[model samples]
Target: MKKFLIHIPLLVLSTTFTFISCTSSKNVDTNLPKDIAERPADEDSQKYEQAQLDKLKASIESESSREKCANASEWTFAPMGAKACGGPQQYIAFPKKMETTLLPRIEEYTQKVKAFNEKYNIVSDCMMIMPPTSVKCINGKAQLITAEQ
Candidate 1:
């Protein structure tokens, strides 16, 4: 009974320390996004990760092209990727019919890219990407068109 009681506090203390170690803390650079890993990915690692991202983006594209688009109202654009300076790197146009599956996957990809950018300390041009004023269908494909505001 005495040994069990004595070890209970030690176990609690050890568990508390373990939990604290795993908890996420605020990063020193408030502007920087949170990193996915403890250390930055090496060059080769970054390349491989980028390849994987390309594959994911390609899959999203393939899924987007599954249906032929006609009406502009049938299409919408989703922001893609995280720019180093903040905001999405660009936007992707897809048919609204696939919104249920496409939006979630796009979000997943965006988050992964954001984490990748943070982990690899990616640098991007601080160019502002404005949202499209409307979507247009040309050559049976959806395209985002921006009008001068």
Candidate 2:
């Protein structure tokens, strides 16, 4: 009886201590800047972003046979009048199943492309006009567009 009473207090104290320890919160430093770097800072990041933007612009406006188009992750958009376009960069012709979703997105995509092009001074030497080609899907592991024969 005495031994049990003594152990009960000790067990209760230990459990209470453990519970408090487990439930206690520690101060977390969440004020640190996410993308901040020391030397090649925001400027470098912007430059890299611009470079990628330029590449996207190029892929969108590519005309030559050597310039192959890449595939998009979810939905592909090939420009209406281009030979082929790259992923997210090239606007794809809508298939039967994709028309409903993609048709509306085309205008928005155009606006975005125009804005990005204008901001980056992407020359519209090969802007698509009319008669969109087949859409190649990225999900198929075949991520490149084959020009129409």
- Assess each prediction's global lDDT (C-alpha) against the native: 0.86, 0.48
- On the 0 to 100 scale, the lDDT of residue 91 in model 2 is 41
What's the lDDT for residue 17 in model 1? 89
| Tens-digit per-residue lDDT, 73-125, candidate 2 | 44344552222232233544333345465455554545555555555665544
Question: Whole-model lDDT for model 2 versus the true structure?
Answer: 0.48
Highest lDDT: which candidate?
1
Q: Pick the TM-score winner.
A: 1
| Superposition-based RMSD of candidate 1 using all C-alpha atoms, in angstroms | 16.5
Per-model tally of clashing residue pairs: 0, 6
Error of 2 at 37 (Å): 3.1
Candidate 1's TM-score: 0.67
